[model samples]
Target chain A: MHNSSRRGFMGKAFGAVAGVGAVGSLVAMKKTWDPLPSVKAAGFTTLDMSIYPEGKLITEKWRGKPIFILRKTKEMIDSQTESQATRDIVVAGIHYMIAIGLCTHLGCIPAYIPAEKEFHCACHGGQFDWSGQVTKTPPPRGLDIPPFKIEGNKMILGEVGPEFQAMKDSGVTL
Target chain B: MAHFTKATSVKDWLNQRLAVEKIEKVMASEYWIPKNINFLWAMGMILAITFALLLVSGIFLLMYYNPDVNLAFDSVNYTIMREVDFGWLWRHVHGVAASVVFLVIYIHMFTGIYYGSYKKGREMIWLSGMLLFVTFSAEAFSGYMLPWGQMSYWAGMVITNIFSLGGLHMDGLVEWIRGDYVPAQAFLTRFFMLHVFLLPLAIMGLIGLHFAALRIPHVNNQDGEEIDFDAEAKKYLDGDKAGSKVMRFANDFMSKDMMVVGIYLIFFFYLVFYNYGFAMDPVNFDPANGLKTPTHIYPEWYFLWSYEILRPFSINIGLMAFGFAQVIFMLLPWLDRSPNAVPASRRGKFKIWFWLLLVDMIVLTAMGKLPPQGIFSTIGLVAALGFIALWIALPFITMNEKKV
Candidate 1:
């Protein structure tokens, strides 16, 4: 009886180790050649937002995700939003309201700070101004907002492109 | 129908005849060989022929093979099973010959090591020989990766990671070795050219230098003694043997080396015909997929122990220890302090360590092949430290024994 049990235990142990080995092998083999997937409609759409004069920011989603657009008024544009919050969002000032939905701290989307012109990440007390710069610390960098181009009357926001340098030169930030 | 005319004049016949005679005379007079050559001296010629065979067969195999990650494994299979005529044979020869060449070199090097072949007069020959071995090793390794198989991919991954130890950021170095962020088509092409052209040329040049250096310092005969041709002949036999100018090539070393060369050729031909080249690792015929690690992953037989050594310890020091062991093995000549070159003279100390090192190497190689766990890994760890211990202890042992 003891011999049989021992044999059974040995068999099970071998099976378990072999199973792990097989899984590892499969995982290793799968990574050798990964063909790039085709682009999806999920990535094709762009966000749209309108900012107010105080470098007031608005957040909205274009491609099923939140975006920050900090529209700066002439006043805020001149001062470049001296508050650390606005200082973070002041990227040439094309889109003033920082609409980037991502939480600067842990990647959870932060709630808006309309009154003080800052983004307060609810998950953490991380703060960012109209410019999207992290005011309250802990977040590594400013929120990532999409690029915007003015299509006649509406500001059309989309993925950043090679023209981002010129956009920044023209007082725009993505 | 075209008609050909026969030779019309005696002058035409004489012109052809003397051309043949002149060719023979040049080969006969100065070029044939030294009369005192022996078996230990034959390795250079054998290595040359082995290298030539590898080069020729390697080039032929390359014609139908692809080195790209996507196509490398398949191309090798395609070449063997379908594409080129007798392509499989060529591939086999290339693969088998690679192992054989290393084996031959090991013996050749041991001959040097054991017989004090690298002592005062032939240090340059030894140096060139070492360089030749290094280049040959590199050539073989680069060629191994060209097949783009599962084993090749992982082998490259595990080997290159050794460079990344010691907080040494080799992101750039890794990229350079791979010829890209990943092993790809570019690496294969470069490796093919290196294996076929550059390395072979380097080998040839080193060989020429090796021979030139050897010629300058006349051949060392057996019994670990230099033959004082002038004094010995003068004392022994009315100076007759000494007076005879270095035996002419026609009746001397040429005849002997030719016989040896014939035997070598017979052996080479037998291997080529009977073995049909050599058995390739089946896994190599499958294309590299980074996601897949084969069940039994090891380097070519030459690098097995070191490969095994590097597997156990995840720590950086283990990797360094492994790499150091390999390079240090080649530095044994300088490492030992036995004073005398011959084994018998330094019998007590040298013989023991020589056997220890040999057994140590064998144990390490065996342990390297086992799954890197249990007794095998423990043995590998012990053997790695043992190499270091032997180097340190040999000197101490020699001193104590001398005092006794």
Candidate 2:
């Protein structure tokens, strides 16, 4: 064969070899890629919000339920306080308000609407007021408030403060 | 109009209309590479291998991987790692390759920046790279969620939560992105969808375009000189020249690319086999429990610098600044009013400024890892300011540069 023909043959031969190699590696790789195991959401911890920064609602998990570590403004706190007798969701915040972020109607997480200052569930259109009061229907009850305590800068979730002890001792339910 | 048969060669079939043999000769066999590129140019070859490595490893991991919020960690840490044969190998390869991809890309990026690869007619190529960079971040971020580990869970929630920085009611938007109120099965599913399909496709498309752009513009050389292909070719075709002035793509550059890829694999495999979890977060081994937050939350090392740089400002400002920093790089060519397309190394002041920016990034990354208190924030603000200053100063510094 001439020099040009020899070079053409060589190039074709190289391409063929490379193609085969690619196929072989892909086949080998398939063994590893064949298993389609599900990726579950992992455990997570939000960074400690020392003093639960104002106008912030950080989500935490408590017993598979999302717990919102919400810092209420002074006005919001007063509004809840004025209506405290009719409706209360336990643990009156000296500061941050903590509530299980699940809808009371069905067990679905509700998105917090900052403009409306309410949590609205997408599943059933369940809405709760800023203070966890049931504002809209489908949700039979208000948002379930979690047992939490004010400990320095952090709002300790799923744990009660000394207020719980004092209230329990005094036989306070509301 | 002859129909191709089973035995007909691809070259023969393609050559009928495509002139496959001739085009290959011209583009690959006969096309010339610039001879002056240093070892830094080898990074392009290494990066190509990194993509394949990640794809194969990722596919394997995905096959064994479960995306359910409840079962993600167990399947990855236990089922895939302990139960499946060679599962651990693929997992490690995938894990290590993620970091390796970023490492090479970082080197490639700085190399490009320093070489002024984005200058002049090459703006679109650089822009495509910037798009690739963005897609890589998205792909990596989505991949981070698949394991359903602590880091995956929290990182998913935290990063998506950043979208709330806009003035609009982003709560609904965040929920839509998360597919739930917070990071949950819905969020995991969306991330899986992107990581498995959408973003990968985008990356593949971008890569194709990136290569096309590179080929069309020809590789930028150190001297910022353009190769007059036809002139050189005519001279070489004539007896006037002993050989072609430019390096042949197939015999010269491709061979070096292949050799460099082989060398890169040695290092890549070493890291994969010995330190599989080197790039992964150890905290990610534990299943996600939303109640107990980690002591200190941090982003991946690649993003740690920006995370720190954007740390001081409120969510809105910090978020904006972080985004602007990456987008700024994409706009670098336009931001640079200087007529010079010369390599950044040649521009003495610009080189110093770039190093200062690198130093600033180093400091910010350290801050991102540390507790944002005491001196850290002070240092972070200074570094952040310095970094921003360097980027913003690009046009001013290069204004007087001679247009090559």
Q: Report lDDT (CA) for all predictions.
A: 0.61, 0.72
Model 1 ranges with Cα > 4 A deviation: A1-174, B1-38, B229-251, B258-261, B264-270, B273-279, B343-346, B394-404
The sequence of per-residue lDDT tens digits that candidate 2 reaches over residues A71-100 is 667776676654432333233334555667
Per-residue lDDT value at A33 in model 2: 33
lDDT of 1 by residue, A1-174 (tens): 999999999999999999999999987755432321321233345333332444444555554345655566666666763443333333343535444465433234566656776666532245666666666644545665555554433555554544444545654333
Model 2: what TM-score for its first chain?
0.56
Most accurate candidate by TM-score: 2
- For each candidate in turn, the TM-score is 0.60, 0.71
- Candidate 1 on B1-404: residue-level lDDT in tens? 54434646765565455655576654554332334446756666677777888878877876777656667777777756577788867776787778888877877886676666666566777788888888888888878887788777666665554454423545455545544434445556666677777887888898888777776554554444555544543443353544442443455555665677678768766776686434367777677755334655667777766665555543355556766766765565555554454533345766677678778877877877665555776788788788668866766655444411
